[model samples]
Target: MSPLELHTRALELAAGVIGTVQPEQLVLPTPCSGWDLRRLLEHMVGQQRGFAAAARGAAPDPALFRDVPVHGDPAGAFRRSAEELTAAFTSASAGAAEPRLRLPEIRDGEPFRLRHAIGFQLLDTLVHTWDVAAALGVPAGTAAAVDRDEPLAAALLDAAGLVPAGPADRAPGRAFRERHEAADGAGPFDRALALLGRDPAWAPPAR
Candidate 1:
């Protein structure tokens, strides 16, 4: 699948997970270390907006990159942001030999190819979707979320070949952590999650 198609699938999966979140579940701890459900949602929304802006060849609005205020309906707010992000990527894909995208957070504001940028976003969305699901106690294969992530993971692996190694390659804040050791018989999806720094067996803290 094309990067855009993969991104759309990733967003759809994320939206499904977000829609299932109960308001009281917002404070639940996720596998993202210090982030709770609310903070994770905020970061997801922010990245959607930030990447959308980057697709337009404009600097991401500093405010949008900050914590998103999920006042009233968090799901509604996220849906709007996802829609805007999809539109921006679609617009950038039109009539462009290659997209000239800039992400200020990476490589000191260097530009990246559109495919690579979309791959980064795809990886983020898929992994975070699992984070939210696991926090909510959604079973591993529930709604085929893991199934959806597998191909997206493969796509990222393919896209990675296109990115040249640079200083950021050796940077401390790499996109994924060292791959965790999985138990015997772990499936591809679980292995992929581990590769991306997520523990497949992670669950929310007991009350």
Candidate 2:
């Protein structure tokens, strides 16, 4: 899958959650432990902006919106943010040197490649999409076979070595625990998010 395709899919998955957020039901819990619908969508928007900034050779502003919507038009706002990220990733020219992802919590002193940025984005979108689904009882991960996705998951999972397992990968030999934990390992959603810069337990910071 190309980066653009991944970006588009990421947006599609994110969009799938908009209706689930509901107009006044923003406080509903999502698959991510601590975050409600509003908070999770905020984080999603922040990620899109931050990733795009990085692609533009700028510092990642994860907190680009320090005080974003806790409750508002969840669907429209999130869709716009998704579009912004898709455009950013698609238009930016980082050349051979991929942008270096400096996510302090996930890992320290690690510089990620450019293509990996798209991969990372895909990972987060895919997992969070499932989170939204799981919390709202929506179905996901039916797009492709796990065997084919393992390679893509492997590259992103390379970063997982430094972090502790999130709720998704706590058990061994499980569906999402990763079949390749020895640096060459890979798996479905949760493992992929671990490889990217998100917490499997990703919750919103306290208000």
Estimate every model's Cα lDDT from 0 to 1.
0.74, 0.56
- Give the candidate number with the greatest TM-score: 1
Q: How many Å off is the CA of 22 in candidate 2?
A: 1.3
lDDT per residue, candidate 2, 44-82, as tens digits?
Answer: 676666676666666434355233563578778777777
Query: Model 2, which residues run further than 4 Å from truth?
Result: 60-62, 65-67, 93-101, 139-187, 190-207
Candidate 1 has a TM-score of 0.83
TM-score of each: 0.83, 0.64
Cand. 2 Cα-lDDT: 0.56
The 10 consecutive residues of candidate 2 with the worst lDDT sum are: 174-183
